[model samples]
Target: MRWTKYWWLVMAVMLISTFAVFAVHDEAKGPEKFGRYEFKEQDKKAATDECDAGGKPGPEFVPTVRDKEPNLALLKDAKPEASSQLEGWCPRRHCVEYLNDGFYNNCRSWIIGAIPGWAQIDIGDVANVNRIYFGSDHSQGFLDRTTADFDILVATSKADPNSDANTWTKVYTHKGDPISETTEFTFKDVEARWLRLHIRTNGGARVDEIEIYGGKDPMDVEPSGKATTTWGEIKTE
Candidate 1:
C-alpha cells in the first residue's frame, strides 16, 4: 500500500533533478560571451578600440630668431674705433669706441660735422650676417644734430674700412633721417668676418648702439619653455 503512494514522488524528483543539470550546462559560457548574448564583430571591435593606444598630436615648428639672439659680439674682442677723422667741431675721436663699448646711454655717442666716419669690428672668424641695428644718438643733452646716413658692409676677411671699400659687400644704405629710437636694417645673409658701419653726418652724426644679427658664431641657447599636456589633450581618434 505505501509503495503506491511513494512511486509518483520518486519519479517527479528524478525529472526535476535532470532538468536542473541541463539548465546549468547551457548557462556555462566562454570569456567572449556577453550578458545573454554571444559577442559579435562590432562588439569585438569596440572592445579592441577601448584597449588601443590614444592618439597623438603632429609636430609643430618653433622659430629661434624671435627676439635678439644673444649678442655674439660679447664673445670676442674687437676694438671699435673710428677709421679716420678730420678736424671738426664735433668730437669724432673714440666715437665708435664708446658706441661699441656695449653700453647704451645718453652720455656717450659719436658725432661728426659733415665728414663721413666709418667704424669696423673684426669678428675674428667668418660668420653669417643677415641684419644690423643701430641706436639713434638724438638723445637729450647733446647738441642739436640730425640723423646720420649710414651703410652696412660685410667681408670675409679683415679689410681696411677706408681703403678696401670695394672689397667689402655693401648690404644696407640709409638716407639721412632724424632717428631717436632703435633703427633696424635687414639684409640677405652673407658670410663675413668683418662688419663695418659707415656714417655720413648730416647736421651731426651720432651712434648710441650697434647690433648685428644672424651670425654663424655659436650662440648660447636656452631650454625651450613649452606647455605641458594633460589627460584632456589625449584623444582616441
Candidate 2:
C-alpha cells in the first residue's frame, strides 16, 4: 500500500509538471456578422455585473470532499486547439470559472468554435479518466442546439484533432439536446496522456464550462461505502 500510494503521488507530480510552461493573456476584437453566428459588443462591465447578479455554483455535480482534485485534465496547461476563441470570451486559461463553477452571470460566457472547435490538455502521460462534464451559458441563449454533436478523442501525442495526420481514438461521443444547466457524461474509462474535445455547432458552439473527472485504481480511492483501513497503516490526506 505504501509503495502504491507513493507511485500515484509520483505520477500526479509528473503530470502536473507539464503545465508549468504555459502562460496566457486574454484580448479580442469588434463584433460583426460572421457566418451563421453573431457576436455581441464587448461589454465587460455588463458581463461582470451579470456574474455578480445571478452566477450560481457551476457544474455542482460530484461533491468536493469525495471528488477532490476531481478534474485531472490540467487547466493550468490548457490552450485553444483551433484558431483560438473570441479573444476575451474564449477558452484557454480564461475559462476557469466554467471549470470550477457553471455560473450563469448573463454576460460572461465561454464560446468555442463555429462547427469544429476544440480544447485539449496534455496530461504528460497515460492517465485514467471515466467521466466528463460540459456546460454552456444560457444567459445569452439556450445551449441545447449549440452544445451537441461532438467527439471526445484521445491521442498519445499532442496532434491536430481535426486532421488525419495524427493518431487519435474516439473514446466517447455525445449527441443530444443540452437543454439543462449542466450535464455529466460517463464512460467505461480511457487511459491516455491527452484529451481533445471536438465540438460541432451549426455555426458556433458556446459552452460555459467543462470538467474531466476520474481516477486510476480502486486501491487509491475511498468510494462511498467501504471497509475500514487495516491496522498499522498511516493514512495521508
Candidate 3:
C-alpha cells in the first residue's frame, strides 16, 4: 500500500508540472499571437489609402463677384418703405422718409434709412467673417453726430419703402453720445438675413452708404430700384 501511494503522488506532481509549463508557454506567446491577429498589412494599407484619399490638403477657397450678385427670382419685387422719419427731407435721396423736425430739432437726422443698404459677405462657405464695408458719399456726410445712436436689425418681414414704423429684429446697437466721421465702428459675430439701420441722435448726420464685406452677406434676392421721385412726394410733415 505505501508503494502504491508513493507512485500516485509522483504521477500527480508530474501532471501539475506539465500543466504549469504549458501555461507559461501560452502566456509568453499570447502577445505575439494577438499582435499578428490585431495588426494586418492589408489593414494598414487600407488605412493609408483612406487617409490619402480623404485627408488630402485642398486649395484655398475664394468668393467671386458672381456669388455677390442678388438672385432676383428668389426676392420679392416689393420695395421697403420707411417706418419713421425723425427729421430731414421726406424721401430724401435713397431714404424713404426724411424728418425735418421733431426729436433732434430740425438738425437733419434721417432715421432708419433703407434696411440693409449693403450686406455682409463670407469668403468661404463655412468661414466666419470679421469685416464689412458700406458705400458712402462724402457730400451725404459721414456718421457725424454729437449724440449718435444706431442699431442694426435683422428683419423677417419686408421693410416698407414708404413708412418708418415697421417691426424688426434688432441685431446690434451702438450706444454712445455720438461718433465722429473719422471714427469707424466695428461689430463681430452678428448673424442676420436682413439688417436694418436705426439712428437716434441729438445732432445732424447722414450715412451715404454701407457695406458688409467679411461676414456672410444676407442672401439678397434682388437689388433696390432707382428712385424716380424727389423726397417731398414720398413723405409728409
Candidate 4:
C-alpha cells in the first residue's frame, strides 16, 4: 500500500510540472490577439487610434526617389513572382505582375490570410544588391490594409528557385506599425540572384511596388527626379 501511495504521489508531481511547463510556453508566445490583429500591444494601440480618428493613422510617407542607380528588378531578364494571387474585388489590380512596374497608385499586389505571403524577384544573375525601396497604396484609407511586418531574403540557386524549401538567407526583417508609401531598407551587400519579400503579417495590404537596386549607395546619389511614375498618371492609367 505504501509503494502504491508513492507511485500516485510521483504521478501527481509529474502532472503539476507538465502544467507548469505549458503555462510558461504560453506566456513566451505572448498575447495572441492585439485588438483585431495578431501581434504586439503597440500595434493594437495604433490600430485603435486609426479607427477612433476619422482620418489616417500615421504620418504620410513621401519617398525620396533615387535616380543615380538603376533598378535591377527592371532588368529585361529579371522576373517577379508571388506565392498566390489575392482573389476577389480588384482581381486584375492585385497581382504579381504589377510589383516592379514603377506604378504606386493604380494597382497593388496583395496577400491576405493566416498563412504568410511572399513576393520574389529573380534579378537574372548574381549581383551585389543592398538597397530595397518598397511602396504601398495609401489611397485605400486604412492603416490595417498595409504591410505590418515582413522579411527580406536572398538566395543563389539554379534549381527550384520558387520553392519555399529552397535555402534562403534572411538579410533584414521589417516591423511596420504600418509600412509607408515608400520604405527604404538597406543591408550589407549580398551577391544573390534571387531576392524575396516575405510578408509575415498584413491586415489587407496593397503592396504597390518593390524596387531592388545594385552597385552604388543611394545616399551618395543626388535626387535628380522621382524614380516612379507620377501619381497623376498612375491614377488615370
For all candidates in order, the CA lDDT equals 0.46, 0.45, 0.30, 0.53
Root-mean-square deviation of candidate 2:
20.7
Evaluate residue 194 in candidate 1 and report its C-alpha lDDT on the 0 to 100 scale.
72
Q: What lDDT tens digits, residue by residue, belong to model 3 across residues 1-237?
A: 999999999999998975653221011111111211111111222322322112212111111111242211112221223444333443323243211110111111233433323221111121122222221222122233233455554433444332244534444456744443213334443333334445555433443223233222433223332212111111101
Most accurate candidate by lDDT: 4
Best by TM-score: 4
TM-score of 3: 0.33
Per-residue lDDT of candidate 4, residues 47-116 (tens digit): 2332222332222211222444556665545677777656753433555765654334323344443447
RMSD of 3: 30.2
Candidate 2 lDDT for residue 85: 55
> What lDDT does candidate 4 reach at residue 153?
81
Measured with C-alpha atoms, the lDDT of residue 28 in candidate 4 is 20
lDDT of 4 at 227: 22
Point out where model 2 deviates above 4 Å. 1-69, 74-83, 87-108, 138-145, 161-166, 216-237
Q: Tally clashing residue pairs in candidate 1.
A: 1
Of 1 and 2, the candidate ranking higher by TM-score: 1
